[model samples]
Target: MTSTVGVSGAGTQDYDVIVVGARCAGAPAALLLARLGHRVLLVDRATFPSDTISTHLIHPPGLAALERWGLLDRVVGTGCPAIDIYAFDLGPFVLAGSPAGEGFDVSYAPRRTVLDKILVDAAAESGAEVREGFTVEEILVDGGTVTGIRGHDKDGGTTIDRARIVVGADGLHSTVAKATAATSYAEKPKINAYYYTYWAGLPMYGQFEAFDRED
Candidate 1:
C-alpha cells in the first residue's frame, strides 16, 4: 500500500521508505520501491550532476542490471564509449580477454556526474520524492527500531520525516550505520591510494586496461 503523510506533534511527514543518499545505490532502490506503489523519499547531501571519486567501470553484469531497469539505453545515449576488451599488464606479460556473461558483451565507464544524475532523475520519475542537497542529521529510533530521519535542506530549514523503514545508502561511514552502532566484520584498512584524471585526445579503441607496477 502507498504511504500516507500524517501530522504528528513534532510536525513530521511520513513515507513508506526514506532513502538516505541518492547516488548509485539509493536512487535505484528508491525508484524500485516507488515503482512497487510505495511512498519513497530519496535524500542526498549533494545536488545532481555532482562528481565523486569512483571506479567508474560498469561491467557486463552491471550493464545487464541497467538493461533490466531500462536505463542502459539512456546511459548509452550519453555518448560514453562501450568497452569490449579487457587488458591486464603485469609488467612481465599481459593477459587480455573480453568480459562476457548474461547476454551482455560490452561495458561502460560513464562519469559519475552524468550517471548519478540519470539515476536520481529516474527515481524522481518513478514517483519518489527526491530532496537534493538535503543533509540527514539524525536517524530517529523508537523502541530500538529506526523510524525516520531529521535533516535539512540547503537553506538550513530543518525537517523531520518519518518512515516505516530507513535506508542507509550513504556509503562508508554512513550516519545511519553509526547511529545504530552497526558493526563491520572482516573490514580492512586502506592498502593503496587512487588518483584519476581525464584526457582529451587519448583513444582506447574499446579497451579497458589495468596496469601493475612495482613502484
Candidate 2:
C-alpha cells in the first residue's frame, strides 16, 4: 500500500532519503539529513506521544546530538533530568549529575515517551516530511541498491516514497536491513542471566521483589 499526499518538491519526482521508523535512531537520522538540506521522508508505525516501555537512558553521544540539533532546550524543558553517571558499586544510586565534559551537559534520564516525542518533533523540525502511524511494508530496490519504500499509513492511506537513500532505523527487526541483505541477527549472542524491573510511578521505595518475564 502507498499513500498519496500533496508531496511538495520538484514535481514529486524523488527525494534524497527515505527513512523507515521514526523513533530514536530513525528520527534523529531523518532530522540530521533534513537539516543537511536533504528532502527526507520519515515514516513510523506509531503516532506522536505514543506510550512505550523503556529506561529512557540517553547516552552522551545522543545528548550531544540533541544539542547539535538545537533541541536541548526541549529536552530540558520536558522534565527529563540531567544525570552525570550511575556509579553503582551495588545500591540503587543517586543523581551524580554534573557538567564535566566539553562544557556540554553530560547527563541524561527521561521518560521514553517524552524523549521519543522530542526526537520525533525534532525530525519534523529538521525539514523532514514526517508521516506517523505508518508501517513499512517493503523496501523498493534496483540493481542491488536502495531506491525507496512502500507502506501503509494512517492518514495518507498508502505510501510509495522514492528516494536515493533508504535508511533502516526500524530497530532490531528491520525490514530495510533484511531486504537490502545488509545485516542479520545472531541467536548465539550472550544473554544476561540476571534480570530487573521497576515499579514506576510507585513511591521511591527501599524494598521490592525481583522477577523476569520467563520466571
Candidate 3:
C-alpha cells in the first residue's frame, strides 16, 4: 500500500543527490545540481587540492564547461598558464595549430590539486555539502533501486547518507561502479603508459606537446 510521505523521514533523506568522488566530474555535477536548488552531498576518499595521477590539461571544450559553471576564472587564478598552441610529433611528421576557436581561445593545465579544490569550493559555495577523506563502504539498495551509501569517516565512524539518487563520479577503478555491478567493455588493451613528476624553471609553460615514439 502506498502511504503518504511526511517530513518525519526528512532527516533520513539526507540529500537529493549523493555524489561520490569530488574530483573534476563529480564536483561540477554537484555544483550544478546544488545551484538548481537540490540538496547535494559530495564525498571523496581524498582531501581537496590533493594530487592524483592523470593528465593535467583541460582542453577548450572542458574550459568552456568550466567557464559556463563560473569557475574558469578561479582555476586560471591559480597561476595555471594558458595554453594557446598545440604541437604533435608524429614519428615521421609534426603537426601543430591553435585548435581553440572563438569562445575558447586557449586552454589551462592546472594541477589536479589546484583544479579540484576550486571545483569543490564552488560546489560548497553553491550549497552542496562537501566531505573529504570519507570512504564509501557500501551502496545501499532498496528492493532493487539504489537508495544511498554507507561510508566510514576518518575517525572510523560509520554514517549512512541517504539520497533520492546516487552518482558515481569516481575514476576508472570506482568502488561505486563495482558495488553497482556496472558492465565494462574494454575493447582494446592498454597500449601505452605515462608517468608524471614535478618540474620547475623549464621552458614551454603555455604549450601542449604530444610526442609519439615507436617502442
Candidate 4:
C-alpha cells in the first residue's frame, strides 16, 4: 500500500529531502533517496494513472536503468510493445535502421498514464512519503536559503514541511525554479509544433516512424 499524509490539523513535519513533482524524474529520485534511509517527501499536484503530453518513448538506456531498478518487467507486463527499428522519410527517399549498441537494442513507448503511476508506486514502495493531489503554493526561504515548503492537500488543508534539501523536479515552468530565480543557458526558441494522438486499433509492428517535411 502507498503511504500518504493528511494535512488536516497537522503540525510542521520534517524530512531529509522534499521533492516536488512525482513523475518520471522526481519519483525515481525519491525512491533512491528513500532507499538510502533518508526521510523523503514526494508531492505532486496530480494523482497517479494520469495522462500527460509526451512522445512516450523510453530508449534503451532508460530501459536499462529501469532494469537495474527492477521495474522493467512490470513495464513489459503492461503489454507495451517493444520498438526496435526506426524509419525516417525525407520526402524523396527514406532512411531506416535499428538501434545499434551492445545492451541497447529496443525501446518502449508506454502511455504516460501507465508509466508515471508505476514510477510513483515504486517510490512509495521504497518508503518515500508520496502526497498525490497536493499543490505546493510556496517555497519557504529563510535568509536566502530554501528551508521548506508550504502546501495544501486536495481538501484545502494546509501544512508546512521542512527539509534539509528541496528539489524542484516540476517541469518546464517549475515553481521552485521561479522562486529561486534560476537562470537558463543555451535555450532556443520553438521552431516547430507537434501534434500527437492515440488511435484505438493501430499497431506499430516494433517500429518507430518519422516523417520530414520542408515548411
Ordered list by lDDT, greatest first = 1, 4, 3, 2
Error of 2 at 167 (Å): 0.5
TM-score per candidate, in order?
A: 0.92, 0.75, 0.90, 0.91
Off by over 4 Å in 1: 1-13
Clashes of 3: 0
Residue lDDT tens for model 2, 88-110: 22234333333445455456666
Give the per-residue lDDT digits (tens) of candidate 3, residues 120-194. 999999999999999999888776667788999898999998888788888877776777677666457888989
- TM-score between model 1 and native: 0.92
lDDT of 4 by residue, 22-110 (tens): 88888998999999999999999999889987549898878888998899999999999989998999999999988655398988899
Listed per model in order, the count of residue pairs whose N, CA or C atoms clash below 3 Å is 0, 4, 0, 0
What TM-score, to 2 decimals, does candidate 4 have?
Answer: 0.91
Leading candidate by lDDT: 1
Which one wins on TM-score? Answer: 1
Give the total clashing residue pairs for model 4.
Answer: 0
Q: Over the stretch 6-61, how does candidate 1's per-residue lDDT look in tens digits?
A: 22233244888888888898899999999999999999999999999875999888
Per-model lDDT: 0.86, 0.69, 0.82, 0.85
